[model samples]
Target: MSDVDAVRLDLNNPVFQRDLHGLQKVERHAALDTLAKLRQPNWQQVYRDKGLHWEKIVSIKPPPGIAALCSVRITQTRRAVAYRDGAFIRLLAIPSDHDATYGKK
Candidate 1:
């Protein structure tokens, strides 16, 4: 992601804060861990030539309206992508189910 393309999280946005806070909760720690793996060099490849790539979407569960597109951070940048109305909200940080699906069997 380019510096200009970098998401500027509105700290004042309640929905953004709420979702970010939810990600910090103890129950979601595993998700946070999965996000960490995504931040690696190999994982950061998707951001090179393409703005969005299929491999970056690690896993997904659906309500059809909401979705979690788990992707890695290339720099020290952190951001999230939530699906809404056929588009991404581009929130704070990507959610994950790492402990549940990344390596556990």
Candidate 2:
């Protein structure tokens, strides 16, 4: 196992805070569980399973001056959007709906 401590979460983002606050109890728990897995060194393997449904978000361009973004399954109906900031996974949002999480199509 790699160093699990390397993963970092960005809790300061207001949008991420708002999205997390909006989740129901069960959804919040699920999201937390996903976050825990992401912190693990074997996250890549964990996300390979269909249940996680991890993938990069290409349709919706990231905000100006930002690099690429990605999304990972938080629950059946929710996703956690984030971007790679060096070794950290800076979670930006946790939209409950799929379309809203990805943006307008």
The whole-model lDDT of each prediction reads: 0.39, 0.76
lDDT of predicted model 1: 0.39
Model 1 residue runs over 4 Å out of place are 1-15, 18-56, 66-79, 84-105
Cα error of candidate 2 at position 54, Å: 2.5
> Lowest-lDDT window of 10 residues in candidate 2?
40-49
lDDT of 2 by residue, 2-59 (tens): 4653666666789998998888899888888877777655546644757667688888
Clashing pairs in 1: 79-93, 80-92
Candidate 1 matches the true fold with a TM-score of 0.28
TM-score of each: 0.28, 0.80
Please give, for residues 15-74, the per-residue lDDT of candidate 1 as tens digits. 645655666455356445534433434423434524333233445453454454444331
